[model samples]
Target: MQAIVVIILILALLLVIFTLQNAMDITINVFFWEIKDAPLVIVLLTCLLLGYLIASFYFFPKLWKLKREYKQMIKFNSELKELHELNHKNDRKPVDDNSDPEGIELDDDDNDGSTFFKD
Candidate 1:
């Protein structure tokens, strides 16, 4: 934040110097409309602001979608973390070594290729 403040201060100083140095009046020709006696800094800064506003409007939808996707990823990450902790907790339980508690029968190689766990 301090670096940002410093950069802004430097930019402001540069702008002030530029504006003072280029204080001469100039004319702007835009298509058929001719603007007379306009300051160079005012014209340049106005164009810069208009460009910024235009670009922001053009990319607003894409920016909103990216923000939404980022939120979904955060939610998914939290849910995955909870599932991982639950699995880790289940891993520390005692084992029977005969039949698994999840209904997975061991040594039952019937070769039928059918799952016993039904929905």
Candidate 2:
């Protein structure tokens, strides 16, 4: 896993370097816009900004709701685990080794007190 991540990081760095070496001009018909002397980094940054803007306008509210619900579910599950532990602790009872049949033994100080059933 670590090797794969390092390889991916190296590849991404090489891509960034390659892109940064090529500065280009672009034109947009939607806004009748023309950009001059724009580096690839700048173009990428603009695209990222526009993408975020579109997402915020059309998709962000629903994504935010889902994130909030995920957090709530995690909290509920943690609380449930605590509650289950507490219930299990309260449900345990003391036992006596003398109640066992042959071929079985129990330590006096053992608090678990689990009974072994014989067939």
Candidate 3:
């Protein structure tokens, strides 16, 4: 996998160098002013860097906020679990059918199996 990645990176770099060598002529436009004779790779890399900078500036804060919210949610869930355990610690009796000989109530509505309002 590492070798494949290295080969791909080398090919990409060679492609960029070949493209740059082929296009020696480049123009730079900055706020209505045109500058000439700039190297193609320099301009291309500069544009790439500028794009990355702009995107990072716009997106990094949101990424950090998401990370913070995720951490807070994890902490809140852990605290909720701890509170539940603490609250239920006093009553630790086994209530399963296999454990209890005397069966517990299965229904809460007087076991009539019919609604009071029905005919």
Candidate 4:
């Protein structure tokens, strides 16, 4: 923050020096209007401000559209994540220990055509 303040102060000093050096009076002639004895710095600053405003106006709509699209994508992603979690939860089944009626343990790895039950 201090560095930014220093840089801003330096720029302000430079602007002051530039304004003092360019404080000459000049006449401006527009299409149907004529202005006399205008400071060169004020004219330049006004033109700069006007150009900035025009550029901002031209790009604001696109910026707003991108912001809205970004918000919609975030909402869609959250909804998809919620749906995937719900499906994952529904896919899992709880194991029941008392499912066997004969009280026998079943061996699932009996591959050699052995007995289907384990003692």
Candidate 5:
């Protein structure tokens, strides 16, 4: 970013020098109207500004559409994540209060599903 700013400043300095050197007066003929004895520097700068504005008009609509699409995708991804979390919450089985922490489930049955215990 700093480099870009430095380059722009250098270009602007060069443009100033070029404009000063080319300061000859010139006449412009528009449709049924004539502009007389305008400075070359002002003409060049005006043309540059107009060209920048025209190019921005060409590109800004597409840029705005892409930005809108990016925001929509982000919203969709967040909704999808929320739904996934909700699904995981619903899919979980309810814990039994009588179940052992060691994962061993003991009922009345013993060996061979028999309730009798030998002493």
Candidate 6:
């Protein structure tokens, strides 16, 4: 913040110096309209301000769309993370090593493809 203020002060000083040095009167003509005895500093500053406004207006919609997309992506990412966490929590079921869920059991000594049914 202090750095920004210092930079702004320096720019203001430079602008004051420039305005004092270029305090000349000039005439401007556009089509049939004529502007007489206009200060060079004011005209230049006005042109700069107009250019800044024009550029800002030209890019405002694109900037707004990018912000909207960024917010939507953040929301989607959070939802996906929550869904993954929910699935991970629900998948923590205990397993039984000794008992099989199916009734059929395989015999280790027999090489034949035969399954024994539990009694």
Evaluate model 2: give its lDDT. 0.78
Local distance difference test scores for all models: 0.91, 0.78, 0.84, 0.92, 0.92, 0.92
Model 2, 1-119: lDDT tens digits are 99999999999998788676766655444466665555666777778899999978888789889999999999999999999999999798776666767647656654666545522
Against the true structure, candidate 6 reaches a TM-score of: 0.73
Tens digit of per-residue lDDT, candidate 1, span 1-119? 99999999999999999899888889999999999999988998899999999999999999999999999999999999999999899688776778778988767575876768742
41-83 per-residue lDDT for model 4 (tens digits):
9999999999999999999999999999999999999999999
Best by lDDT: 4
Deviation (Å) of 101 in candidate 5: 27
Model 1: ten consecutive residues of lowest lDDT: 110-119
Please give the distance, in angstroms, between residue 96's alpha carbon in candidate 4 and its true position after superposition.
18
Candidate 4 lDDT at 97 equals: 71
The model with the greater lDDT, 2 or 4, is 4
lDDT of 5 by residue, 16-119 (tens): 89988999999988799899999988988899999999999999999999999999999999999999999899799998999999999767646566455544
User: Which of 1 and 4 is the better model by lDDT?
Assistant: 4
Report model 2's TM-score to 2 decimal places: 0.38
For model 2, the stretches where C-alpha displacement exceeds 4 angstroms are 1-48, 93-119
Error of 4 at 24 (Å): 0.9
TM-scores, each model vs. reference: 0.62, 0.38, 0.64, 0.72, 0.61, 0.73
Descending-TM-score candidate ranking: 6, 4, 3, 1, 5, 2
lDDT for each residue of candidate 6 in 25-48, tens digit (9 for 90 to 100): 999998999999999999999999
Candidate 1 stretches with Cα past 4 Å from truth are: 1-5, 93-119
Model 1: how far residue 32 lies from native, Å: 3.1
